[model samples]
Target: MKRQLHSCALAALTLLSTLPAGAQHAEPVPSEQRVTVQGMKNASAWFKAESQHFVVYSDTSRASVFQLLNNLERLDYLLRLYTSAYGKPQPLESKLTLTFHKRPGALAQFADTPPRDAVGLYSSCSAGVQGAGVLLAPITELANAELSKAPVND
Candidate 1:
């Protein structure tokens, strides 16, 4: 899993390098400077749980957190079985933190807004070169906002 993240970051950098330098905003920022969310808590003031894999940061009930973790464990197990080049398994090298919002619309926004029905995301990052990251929406609220602006059907 750690390998995959680095590979992804490297691949993205390579691709970005190919684009015209003028079109791409390539400002070299130090990793420490790029991390704004690091100091901030991922979950809200309510309902937080810390584990080896993640810190469940949200107001979600413990029951929901357990259910979510069960799903994540299943995913991790599947990911470990995933074969890369030469048939190597992609195991996670680090613990990941997850923050859940009760209302989908309450989730964070990105450069490209997420879908209203987005359930969750594995990760997120700033536009920094090093690919420092964190993970997962108020898309549902945005969706409702957009729907309110839609033209009424006959």
Candidate 2:
């Protein structure tokens, strides 16, 4: 009887070892790694803030969308402080549009000029229909070293 019990236990151990690593519980993919396809959210779906100070473009999810908005708001406040301390040649427009992309490659479609491998871009154009806005790449790409470390002023 003892010998049979030992054989059964060994068989069970062998069976468990043969199973795939995910047979028990698969690890969940991190949110940053689970990027959706580019342009998954259409331009029409962009959330407009109450102040119209800026518009958020992305399919990342409402929570992330709002977080960007808040960050922009804070950035604006900081800019105001700097301008007041120094002084601007002319008044600046408060309204803005932020284009947040799920992937770095997606920015090429919207760029008026050649796109860089930038993680984020604050850009504008002199004329010909390219307006002012900031383009944000995926959170995972934030540390890309190829692009300029400084933000593009336009």
Candidate 3:
């Protein structure tokens, strides 16, 4: 997991380096930077970590989960920079929910129409107030890969 996070950060930095020198820092608001982590009511013993744009629920260790989330934030920053420059920036109406499941088929249970042998799943409800965007991932499945190949699973 550390290797994956390291590679993700390195890739993000590499992308950042390619940006023009005048790039502005994409800092989260002070209030949004505050993080709250807690255990959820589930058989999987899920932990919830919420920040500015994402709310992650995982069965992984706190340190590793935070590391994964940090990479996600970095990607969001890059996306925002790109959208602001080349397209209409559509700010999120609510935080996106990301859940990492340890078991292979666990993620399918959350889907309205479960996939056939899916490694992960994503669902979004456009009519919902928050848009209800969610990403479900199989952490154990992805963890088997080497650093260079790790992100390909994502």
Candidate 4:
């Protein structure tokens, strides 16, 4: 009887070891749809800001994008300064269109800060366009506000 019991216990232990110890779980894969918005002139980088998150898109290399995203908090401060200097606070509902362009081998253009007139709308020719680094914050803030106010189901 003792021998039979010992063998049964060993078999049970082996069976348990062969089977999964517990429920298996897998981590969710991250989303792949990365949005890119191009900056003006020498900047020539795509900027995507979603829910306070920002990324720079570069066809040449990803380093630029990673740099921008990592320094977003500082960039937000710069944006507020630009908006205060050039733009008036309007209703959040105001829709503004922005265009991005790249200047070859001219990263200095971004540092120089193109005149407001040079960054105008594609169609209007008179409307001013601000740098992506400058405009992303207010737009993101307003978007977040709108989202929070939206109705939710329990």
Query: Each candidate's TM vs. the true structure?
Result: 0.42, 0.44, 0.48, 0.29
Best by TM-score: 3
lDDT values, one for every candidate: 0.52, 0.55, 0.62, 0.43
lDDT for model 3: 0.62
Per-residue lDDT tens digits for candidate 1, residues 21-41, read 567777987542122345685
* Candidate 1: C-alpha lDDT: 0.52
State the lDDT of candidate 2 residue by residue for 1-154, as single tens digits: 9999999999999998895666577698764423445767533444434234676556455666666676666666767788886876445554555666555465556556535655555656653122223345322222235235746333
Output candidate 2 Cα RMSD: 13.1
Against the true structure, candidate 3 reaches a TM-score of: 0.48
The weakest ten consecutive residues by lDDT in model 3 span: 129-138
* Candidate 1: regions farther than 4 A off: 1-45, 84-92, 108-112, 124-154
Q: Report the lDDT of model 3 for residue 117.
A: 66
Off by over 4 Å in 2: 1-52, 88-94, 112-116, 126-154
Clashing pairs in 2: none
How would you encode candidate 3's per-residue C-alpha lDDT over 51-145 as one tens digit per residue?
Answer: 77888776656666676677667668867887886777556557777776566567556776666666556666775222122234422323323
Better of 1 and 2 by lDDT: 2
Q: Give the TM-score of candidate 4.
A: 0.29
Q: In model 1, what is the error at residue 21, expressed in angstroms?
A: 82
By TM-score, the better pick of 2 and 4 is: 2
